[model samples]
Target: MASSPFLNEVRTSIRVRGMSIRTEKTYIYWIRFFIRYNHCRHPTEMGAAEVVDFLGHLATERNVAVNTQRIALNALAYLYNQFLKQPLGDLES
Candidate 1:
């Protein structure tokens, strides 16, 4: 898969701002899964349905704990809010 430009931007900003490595890793993981959940489509082209699908996969398919799922969601939300500057209020399940 091609490296996502959006993910690159997010990583760059996080590194430049001196974010913790854990935070950077978590954000990248979420963004990568988000992309795959939408069939490798760009996040800019995805909507609440895609987000919901990804979260559902985490909860049901992956059997992640509630807190873990929430953390992933928060990571993705940060990417949406900070990197893309896209409003995520409408994406809430």
Candidate 2:
């Protein structure tokens, strides 16, 4: 995926909020993965359904562990809640 200033800005925002570097990296990874999984669509142009799809892929295809699924969910929540200011309600993750 192309490097995005938007994602960089998300990292900065996480840093500014006193998140650890590891947390920043994890969040960025999920954000990038999400965007790429959605054909590089901007997060602002997507929503909870896309998140469900990604997480579903992890479950049914990648067989990601439970904690891994949770981490992905958290990252998406941060993306929508903090970055886009659009909180996803009742997301199944």
The models' CA-based lDDT, in order, is: 0.80, 0.91
Q: Report the C-alpha lDDT of model 2 over 33-55, residue by residue, as the tens digit.
A: 89999999999898989999999
Error in Å for residue 43 of model 2:
0.4
Instruction: Give every collision pair in model 2.
Output: none
For each candidate, give its TM-score against the true structure: 0.83, 0.94
Q: Write the per-residue lDDT of candidate 1 for residues 4-93, one digit (tens) a residue.
A: 677888889889879899989888888888787777888888756777788899999999999988888888787777777885776655
* Model 2 ranges with Cα > 4 A deviation: none
Best by lDDT: 2
Find the 10 residues in a row with the least total lDDT in model 2: 1-10
C-alpha lDDT of candidate 2 relative to the true structure: 0.91
